[model samples]
Target: MSVVASMGRKEKAQGAEPSIAPLIELAGPDMERVNALILDMAGSNADMIPEIARHLIDSGGKRLRPLLTLAAAKAFGYEGDNHVKLAASVEFMHTATLLHDDVVDESEMRRGKLSARMLWGNQASVLVGDYLLGQAFRMMVEVGSLDALRVLSDAAAVIAEGEVMQLAAAKNIETEEAAYLRVINAKTAALFAAACEVGPIIAGSAPEMRAAYSAYGTNLGLAFQLVDDALDYGGSSMTLGKRVGDDFREGKVTLPVVLAIRAGDARERAFWKRTIEDGAIEDGDLDRAIGLLRAHGAIAETVSRAKAYGEAAVAALSATPAGPYRDALVGVVAFCVSRVS
Candidate 1:
């Protein structure tokens, strides 16, 4: 049977939320190596560099991106140690992005703790993020796969572009869904695509398999981000790892806001304008925003869109040979979209 077909049966039988534990288990030994490489590479004579990097790295994130890199490599029967290097590179890239994002977003919390910027200051955070990026590139070069390096390097540039795109789109109530998607595709999905693509590239797999992994990563990323957009308003602090309504407070024009704006009346539009566009949020504004999101079904719609992307991600896995690794990857899609459930 196909991987997706098997996944469906398992879901039906289990009738429970899908878990990432399987992927974690499959990647455990390699992940131990990846973690060591990360710590070793993050070290420097300038103690603050490792300090800042480790602060975020030690935070309780699931490390999903690097796991994807490792899982993708193993899925295609690769046995080389280069996958470990690539996985660590992917993680460093992700960690650097998070550090920079906290600085850009001016966020005070990450992974249920104080942000690196909050503790170390923005300059330290940014510089350390740059340091990590440099380290990530060095690791990529050590892998000796020009194709993998090119994919990851291109993703780095795209992630920067996406951040810029998001910055421009911030507080623009008129930002359409397409424009928002473009920002995420560059900022978030680009790295995911590169992380998964490197697996096939290192494995010397066919172009078709590489394309499949890229598609899976891209759709998974889109789904993941869309769920985050929904969770910002509708989820708990425990689930979000930050205070609820952070996006609304920060005037982030996520999909829920865009959809809410589209469906709102003139008075509602003015509310969005005053709060999101003009940065005039006041007491109870977040509650009002959540109410409007629910009233207009924006949150539900966002989750629905996320589910569509999750299905697309599962579909992309059809090209790969079926096994425990593929099954775990498919379960990951369910786990991502199931957060709102």
Candidate 2:
């Protein structure tokens, strides 16, 4: 079977979401350290702090960002504990964003469970997310590399900015594809780039190597987000954690929606405006929406675009030291875009 088929079978047999198990296995020893640090830092006397934090932290989403950090460090032959700190910090930052995102999106579900906001309330979720951010910064400082600190800190700012941009673009039927790319680039890809770059930086790799990893991560991130957006329409709820068409219900304009909107005729345009911009959704709208997307080949086109970025991610690794870690990184790109299959 092909890689995608093999992955699909594994997921079905295990009754789990598709995973980057190869990368995780490759970084097993380091990931154990990262997990321990995560649990350690998640502790709190406030009770609710750790409660709310762990609720989301223990969610089943694969720790892909942190894995990238550990794998990158391993690829560069780093033999220090700083990568552990950085990896934990990367995970904290990612978790914090997820907490905040669920609240902002008013999402009811996350990773196959009720969202933190649904369980605790928006106020508690936001505060716990803030607490995670504080802990993440502290971890970055403990690593004691100003360059690593700068990279992660910058990514934090970019992620917040991306959230705001997505909010602005929300329900705006006129949002362009470039605008969509920018939102996902900052919201998602920025962290991926930072996670990978910090590894090389802490490993004392040359600047050229750092840039190569950053490029690899950025492109990989872009592809990952595109596939996710497509999956929101085409994938099963078991695969997505939340119900499919959450984006449609929320009126979030992703790349597929963008392409569909641009190609739609007068009647189709009215349908998009009413359902997406105006949120006047009704039964069968989702099926109709899927029909429109298929009619325009938006889903296929989005996957095609993802494949291009995946190729770029593989190309960015040309300067990365050749080894198993390097090969696994390339496989990560393949696995990311293959979710659609």
Candidate 3:
């Protein structure tokens, strides 16, 4: 059975699945300003910059990262306009990374559409990503909060490091779970942590509160990525925004593959080495890979781990005040993990 189908109906009905609508409703006004700022900043004298940038920007992503920034700030009673700027900066940073990532992964689709790299070419995609990064920094400086800038800049550096680490680990069947976690922590969770932390920083919240938001974002990001990894082998293309098995096709060593390799017999090990380590995937290979992942319960275990991270993310929010904002942030974590359930 599919992952979602495997879940008990009682679990699904008991709020095991949640909506981000609460977070969206709570941050409505600020998100409007953030959306406007994003559009304004995406503009440029050079036509191609905006063209390439808007193509991806216009694609219908949930804008969850920037919303996290806005919610964290509003949760702490921040009243300044700087939160808007920081929200835009977070989004630009995210968009820039997606642009670069598509190129790095040689991905052809994003958000159910052709990727920027597929249409604009890798050179243009990379350059426009650089442009977005420049704009992200400019907005960060405009905020004039050194703490926010430092957090975001540090995340940018760490994201680059994560990409490099993933590149090195790619197609290596021996990649351990700890090494995989490190890669995702850097590439995905770093930005999420920074995005949530900057809000509390700009609000001048207590150090403990700031740390709480950072931890929440970090755990939420881990859950989000883990779900994505599981969905790649178990979900539909529409839900994935790309083909299922794309990770397998690319020879990526995600958690499911790692676990399967550990539990697999000697003959199965040869199959993985031939397809992943050797990059010799043939027809019917993706089906075989998925079958093995299911046989070993790797996908189920990956989802279980994601649920643990989601629970940790919700726990981190206990440090924040109990209100609609905190409830909504908790909802965000549930929404992320629910994709698999």
| Cα TM-score per model | 0.97, 0.94, 0.95
Model 3 lDDT per residue over 1-341, tens place: 12223333434667555678989999999999999999899999989999998899888888999999999998999999999999999999999999999999999899989999999899999999999999999999999999999999999999999999999999999999999999999999999999999999999999999999999999999989999999999999988888999899888999999999999999999999999999898999999999999999999999999988888888888868888898888778767877887
lDDT of model 3, residue 195:
93
Please identify model 3 stretches exceeding 4 Å from their true place.
Answer: 1-17
Q: Provide the global lDDT of candidate 2 against the true structure.
A: 0.91
- In model 3, the clashing pairs are none
Candidate 2 Cα errors over 4 Å, as ranges = 1-19
Whole-model alpha-carbon lDDT for candidate 1: 0.92
- Candidate 2 per-residue C-alpha lDDT over 230-254 given as tens digits, one digit per residue, 9 for 90 to 100: 9999999987889999999999999
**Model 1: how far residue 254 lies from native, Å:** 0.1
Q: Who wins the TM-score comparison?
A: 1
